[model samples]
Every structure is written in C-alpha cells, then in structure tokens.
Target chain A: MIRVQSEAFDAGAELNAFSTQAAGAGAVVSFTGVVRDVTGGLSGMEIEHYEGMTEKALGAIRADAMQRWELADSLVIHRFGRLEVGEVIMMVATASKHRKDAFEAAEFLMDYLKSRAPFWKKEITADGADWVASKDEDEDALSRW
Target chain B: MQVLYFAWVRERIGVPREEVETSAVTVNDLVVELRAREERYDAAFADTSALRVALDQELAEFDAPLSGVREVAFFPPMTGG
Candidate 1:
C-alpha cells in the first residue's frame, strides 16, 4: 500500500493493520518517521509535493522494495504539505519470515525514499527558509547497502 | 510535455510548473533543450551534480530515454524524513 496525504497518520494503527494481516509472516518490521524539531539546524519544516505524482513515486519505490526483499507484504505512507513538529510524517512496514529481512528491507526502503522520492522539504529557521538538499551521506548509505 | 520543478530548483527558476514541446529523446537531451531557454534554466541546470530528475514521477537517470514520457520533473536531492 502507498499513500500521500496531508493529515498525520497513526503509526500504531498502521503497523497493526499490516502485521495482523500477515499471518504467515514470523516477523514484521516497521518504521515511523516524525517531524523533528531540528533538521539541518532548522526549527520547522514545510513539505510540498505533487499529490498524484507523490503517490505514484511511492508506489514505484514500494514495488522496487518488493523485488529486492523477500517479504510477505510492504506498506509506505507519507505526508505532504505543511507539517508541525512531533507529527507522524511517514511510515514503512515490511513483513517477512525473518527479522533480518524485515528490518533491513524497512531500512532500505526509507534510505531510498529519502533521496529518491518526489517530495521536497523547506526548512524554516531564525535566519530564513531553505530547501533541504539530498545529503551526500544518504547516497553513500544507499551505496553501501 | 509537462515540466515540474521542486525545491531550490523551483525557487531559482521562479516557477513550479510549465509545459513544453520538444523533440528531445533522452533526459540529457531535454536538459540541453531547457538550458537553452534562458539564464534561469541555464543556471538551474548549470551543475548536473546539484540536480536530480524524475520521469513520469519515477526517479530516473540522466541518461534515461524520454520517449513516451508525459511528465518530466527536475529537483535537487530530496531531504524528507
């Protein structure tokens, strides 16, 4: 499943929804990403995305994860538009028979999503606002894996 | 074709959306076409190192073919959490 929405989502509810349905899976690994108070020294974040394109991009990323990881299922949900601190911004769930596959797949998905997704985030700080750059470290991480 | 810009690229270009008609067959070719538009396009694409691309919303390579693509998007690397 893939969703790009403005409203904050319930991570616990989403994790339970994915895990409970994966009866054959022995392990379910999920990641919940929230709006942090500090990002690259910025105080707040505002994310913008083309709604239709955002969902389509996420669907493609999910499909790629499915091909790379042996999993029972996967779900990716991301929020767009303005977001406040401490709000749930995104989540990724991977169900697999082993913990390693499930955990690694979820991590891999998030790493790719960071640099590959269509969403753009602008940071508002005391000085002013600026769009965040795809960190070189992010690409390095993806390359190492 | 539909052209979309995001992040600093949008800010630098001064517009978020545009439509263009061109015969470019690859992403590299399209960038060359756009760069010819004006200083903003030239400056926005000055360094491919600072830019990334998506074709029909899927992350794509610079050398990727653009045939049959309805939308082409340009932006810097994403910094989403």
Candidate 2:
C-alpha cells in the first residue's frame, strides 16, 4: 500500500493496521520519520510534492522493493503540506518470513525515498524559510543497492 | 505541451505551471528555448547540473526526445524522505 496525503496519521495505529494486514509474515520492520527541530527556534516545515507524480513514484519504489525482497506485504505513507515540529512526516513498513529480508527491504525503501522521490522540504523558522538541499550522503547511500 | 517547476525553480520562474509551444526536439533544446525567453528562465536554468528534469512525470535525461511528451518538469535534486 502507498499513500500520499496532507492530513496527519497516527503512526502506532498505522503500524498495527499494517501488521495485522500483513498476514503470514514472520518478521516485520518499520521506520517512521519525524519532523525534528534540527535547529533551535524552528517553527514549522513545509513539504511540496508533485501531486500526480508523488503517488506514481512511491508506487514504483514499493513495487521495486517487493520484487527485490521476499515479502508478504509493504506499506508507505507520506504526508505533505505544512507540518509542525514533532509531527510524523512519513513511514515505511515491510514484512517478510525472515528478519534479514524485512530489515534490508526497509532500509532500501528509506534510501530510495530520501533521494528518488519528488518531494521538497522547506524549513521555516522565526527569521525566514529555506529549502532543504539534497545531501551528498543521501545520494551516496544509493550506491550500496 | 505543459512545463512545470517546483521549489526554488518555481519561485524563480514565478509560476508553478505553464503551457509552452515549441519545436524543440529534445529536453536540452526545450531548455534552451525557455532560457531565451527571459532573464528569470535564464537564471533558473543557469546551472542545469544543479537541476533535474522529468518527462510526463518520469525522470529523463536532457538529451531525451521530447516528442509526444505532454508534460515537462524542472526542479532541484529531491530532498525527500
């Protein structure tokens, strides 16, 4: 499953739902990204995404993960628009018969989502706002898989 | 065809989307046409290496043919998660 929305979601509830739906899997691994206040005095973050393309890109990434790993199910939920600090930005969960598959798939999904997805984040502070630049480390992470 | 910009590219171009009519054959040619339009386009495209392009919502190379492409988007390297 893949979802791209502006509304906030409960990570715990979502995880439970995903686990319940991923029947027959022995191991499940999940990662949740939070809107942290990396800099002090930060007010909020604004996320902009290509509406038609966001879902398509996420679907492609999820499909790729499924092909690469022996999985029972997978889920990716990402939120856009204005989000305050401490909110959940996105989550990825993968289910497989073994822990190694689940862990590797989850990490692969996170790596691709960080650089391949078409979403841009802007950090808002008391002074002003600035677009978050893509880190070289993020791009370098893709070389592993 | 339709041209789209996102993030700082949109800010520089001052519009999210626009209809473009051109006889350009490839993404790079289309970019050249856009750069010739105004200073804003020139500045937005000043560093093609710092940007990325998509054709019909799928990532494409600058040398990719534009024929039959309905949408073209330009933006900086994604910072998603």
Candidate 3:
C-alpha cells in the first residue's frame, strides 16, 4: 500500500497494523522519518507534492520492491503540507520470511522514495525557507540494486 | 498542453501551471520556447542541468520527444521521503 496525504499519522499504530496484515511473515522492518529540529535552527517544514503524480510514482516503486524482494507485504505513507519539528514525515514498512529480505526491501524503498517520488521539501528557518538539494549519496544508493 | 512548475521553479516563474500552445518536438525545444517568452521563464530555466522534467507525470529526459504529451512539468531534483 502507498499513501500520499497532508494528514499526520501515528507511526506506531501504522506499524502495528502493517505487521498484523502481513500475516505469516516472520520479519518486519520499518523506518520512520521525522522533521529534525536542527538544533532549533529549523522552525518547521513545508512539503509540496504533485497531486496526481505522487500516488502513481509511489505505487510503481512499491510494486517494483515487491517484485525484487521476497516480500509478504509492504506499506509506504508520506505526508505533505506544514510539518513541525519532531513530526513524522513518512514511514516505510516491509515484511518478509527473512530479516535480510525485509531489511533490504525497506532500504530500497527509502532510497527510491528520496528521489523518484514527486514530493519536495522546504525547510523553514528563522532566516528563510530553502529547498533541500538532492544528495549525491542518495543517487548513488540506487546504483546498488 | 499544460506546463507545470514546482519548488523554486514555480516561485521564479511566478505560477504553478499555465496552458501553452506550442509546436516544440522535444522537451528541450519546449524549454527554449519558454525561455524566449519572459525574463522569469528565462531565469527559471537558466540551468538545464539543475532541472528535471516529466511528461504526463512520468520522468523524462529534456531530449525526450514531446509528441502526444498533454502535460509537461519542470522542477528541481526531487527532495522526497
């Protein structure tokens, strides 16, 4: 499942629900990204996304992960709009019969989500707002798979 | 067709989207036409290397042909997740 929305969600509850739906899976790996306080230099974050494309991009990648890994199930939930410090920005959960598959799949999801998804993030600081640049490492990470 | 901008590109171009009538054959050709229209568009598209393009919501190359494409989007490299 892939969800793109402006509403905040409970990571704990989401993980629990994902685990339950994964059925006989023996391993579940999940990741949660939060708005870092940046030593209080950051006040908040604003996320902008392509309304029609965000969902399509996420679903395509989720399906790719399912085909690449031996996964029982997978979930991706990414939020948009104003997000305060410490707020959960996104979550990824993958369940499989082995830890290796679950772990690798989760990492793959994160890597692809960083660049392929059509969502942009701008950090709001005391001075002004700036869009986060795409990291070379993030692009390099994709060459692995 | 519709041309859309995002992030700083939208801010620079001063609008999120607009309808444009064009006969450009490729994304690069379209960029050239947009750059000719106004100073803001020229500024937003000043650096082709710093930009990314999508055709009908799918990522594509600047050299990608615009044939049969109804929507075009230009923005900086995505900073998602």
| Candidate 1 chain A worst ten-residue window by lDDT | A35-44
Q: What is the DockQ of candidate 2?
A: 0.92
Q: Which of 1 and 2 is the better model by TM-score?
A: 2
Q: Estimate each model's TM-score.
A: 0.86, 0.99, 0.99
Docking class of 1: medium
Q: Residues B1-81, candidate 3, lDDT per residue (tens digit)? A: 999999999999999999999999999999999999999999999999999999999999999999999999999999998
Positional deviation of A25 in candidate 3, in angstroms? Answer: 0.6
For every candidate, how close is chain A to the native chain A in TM-score? 0.89, 0.98, 0.97
**lDDT at residue A109 of model 1 (Cα atoms):** 87
Interface DockQ per candidate: 0.66, 0.92, 0.92
Q: Which whole-number lDDT from 0 to 100 does residue A139 have in model 1?
A: 80
Q: How many backbone clashes does every candidate have? A: 0, 0, 0
Clashing pairs in 2: none
| Real contacts recovered, all predictions | 0.71, 0.90, 0.88
Where does candidate 2 stray beyond 4 Å?
Answer: none
| Residue A10, model 3, lDDT | 99
- Scored by Cα lDDT, where does model 3 land? 0.95
- List the TM values for chain B, per candidate: 0.96, 0.98, 0.98
lDDT of 3 by residue, A54-99 (tens): 9989999999999999999999999999999999999999999999
